[model samples]
Target: MYLRLENISKRFNSFVANHNISFSVDAGKIHGILGENGAGKTTLMNIISGLYQPDTGKIYLEDKPVKITSPKGAIKLGIGMVYQHFMLVPQLTVTENIIMGTENSWCLNLRQKQEEIAALSQAYGLKIDPAAQVENLPVGTQQRVEILKVLYRQAQLLILDEPTAVLTPTEVESLINILRQLAGAGKTIIFISHKLEEVINLCDTVTVLRRSKVVATTIAKEVTPQQLAELMVGREVVLQVNKSASVPGKVIVSVQNLSVANDRGIPAVSNVSFQLRAGEILGIAGVDGNGQRELADAIAGVRSIINGKIEFNRSCTRQKIGYIPEDRQKIGLVLQFSIAQNLILKAFKNLPFCHHFLLQPPAINNHAQVAMAEFDIRATGEDIKVSQLSGGNQQKVVLARELAGEPNLIIAMQPTRGLDVGATAAVHSRLLVERDRGAAILYISTELEEVMAMSDRIAVIYRGEFVAILDAEIATIEEIGLLMGRGTGGRKSAGTG
Candidate 1:
């Protein structure tokens, strides 16, 4: 075996993040670590990469027991970790970012380093421009830079956490190809992700973790995505969405030449116009930072639109719209607040949750109990802070709060992100239920598969414009993939208006 963990465990105060986890990876093979959020996958990887010391157990490389005390030590021991979030400095060029710590000389030879990095990139089939600034490059190219950085450190074993989460389908394919090439060249890879299709497609062997423990370890080809999902979630998970054909009603939301700005006040969404009808899901598919966030924020009344008109059929007030922000911790819920408080965040001023000039704890608690039961939220109590719960549970709290009065319009932005398969299924089912009850859903996600599966009509957003809109049933993944890449080939099948 190239890498092995024996009886490894980790703890954080009262919680056990990883418990007695053991797995082995052979050299020249790609191994997958599958789990939900807070399922010890990250903790195990952290221990392996020397970010955290294990409380108990041991790690062996090449059949020799080893101690990884620090990130530098891990690198010295031929281990490299590419986190879900890239670590490169956005302001610097790829060559500068990669050689920043490795080179010791005050008078650095940047041109020489760039040539070396370019040679490495070419040899490994990981094509990247070493001269390009990290922030200016596309997300896919940025990921290539990350891999090159790891390889440049002379790593034999590479650990990647959710590397494809923000990549387009084409980019994902490119990454998979690169990984396969690396494995072919005698490199060992540990892939961690909640995306089962990629895991099943890329991994030789798979380990499923649930609630800080290993549930199963098996050959990847022997199991389906559904089986892996069940193993990770410890339940029967519905992989395919079972929803009736959409019955789209009158337009619930209309945006005419909508223009919205990003946090820096620069135009992110420009001249984007679309209509969302009642009892239908209009999924906006695009790569990250392609105006999806700004559009969603503009529609949710969180950001001011610079131009165009947003018209609602039901009411002028924002209460008629239920918004689920993309970043759950940052925008969806207050981490410091209790579950009950988060659940009543939008409805706190109402009659049942609050009396005239006073607060109603009992009513709030009662509402929380019902919401918890309905949403299958697992928590110790309503008074526990939302920050204490797992990602899935925190999302449920947001859902409970947003769906309280059954708003006519739902702006769901990455609602199932960072959630387990079971939680994702639950959220999808709830959305479908709401759709059947005549709610207009503006489902915005960079997850193409999800948008394709859930939407009745799919809109391809490229560079802040709605380039194409097509019926989901007729829209193929390849067509959407091309559109997401800003290609002109797929526009023939799209509706202009």
Candidate 2:
């Protein structure tokens, strides 16, 4: 075995993050650690990468036990980790970022280091400009720079956490190819992801972790996606959403000639128009970096549009639209607040919990308790900090809070991005229920399967344009894939706006 974790365990206060987990990976192979959000997968990888000291356990590299007390120690032992969030300084150039901590003198060896970085990028099929600033690069290229940072450090074992969560389908395929090439060149890869299809396609072996324990490990080729889902959740998994056909009613939201600019002052969405009806779920599918973010933000009243008209239904006069942003930490909820506090974010001012000038703490707690119970949020109490909950449970809090407002429209962006099988199912069920109750939903996601399964009508967004709209019942994966590519010779369908 190239790497073996023997009885690794960790705890924080009274919560056991990792419970005596054991697993091993071979040399020059891609080993996947599969688990739901907060299933101790990150904790295990952090322990091996020296970010945390395990309460009890040993890590073996090449069958030799080593004590990795810090990140620097792990680097010296040939173990490197790339975090879910990129670590590069935004203002630094690519070459500077890669050679930030090198031993060579900057004044004397700057040119040589630049050459080395260029050579490494070429060798790994990462076409990145060395002089480009990190902030100016696309997310896909930034990811490549992260990989280059680890490779430049001469790491033999690379641990990646949720590497493709924000990537488009095309970029995801490129990443899989890159990993395969790295493994082909005798590097060991420990990939952590929640996407089952990607895991089955890219990994040689898979280890399933559930609630801080390794439940099963098997060859990736021998297991189906269903089997892997079952192993990860410890039950029979249903990969499909069960929703009856919807007879969409009157328009809930109408957008006319909407246009929005990107961060660089370029038009990211141009002259886009659509109508969302009550009792209907309209899914927008697209590659990452498309206008999905801008479009969703425009509809949710978060972003100012250059030219547009937005009309919400008359019944929703009391409650504004609810928006579940793609980056939960940045826009969805306040991580430092408690569950009870976050539950009152938008509705605090206009509630029974507010009386003239005083806030009613007891009423707020009561509302929070009811939400937690209804949503099955696994938190200790209303006083427990939101950040203390697992990623899945944190998402549940966001969902519970937003849905409790009884909004007429819900703009859910990547709602189930990093959730495990059970949580994904729960989210799907909630959306279906909302649809049945006549709430208009705008579901924006990079996962085509999800868009196809839950939507009544599907719109494909490509490069600042709504390229095509098709009925969900008639759209095939191949059709959507072609639309995503925006190639020269694919069937172009008309918009149903």
Evaluate model 2: give its TM-score.
0.90
Which candidate has the top score in TM-score? 1
List candidate 1 segments past 4 Å from native: 493-497
Q: Best by lDDT, which number?
A: 1
- Name the lDDT value of residue 150 in candidate 1: 89
Expressed as tens digits, the lDDT of each residue in 34-125 for candidate 1 is: 88888998889889999999999999999999999999999999999998888989999999988878887888888889999999999999
Clashing residue pairs in candidate 2 are: none
User: Candidate 2 on 121-195: residue-level lDDT in tens?
Assistant: 999888898888998886777999999999999999999998987665667778889999999999999998878
TM-score per candidate, chains pooled: 0.98, 0.90
lDDT of 1: 0.90
Clashes (backbone N, CA, C under 3 Å), per candidate, total: 0, 0
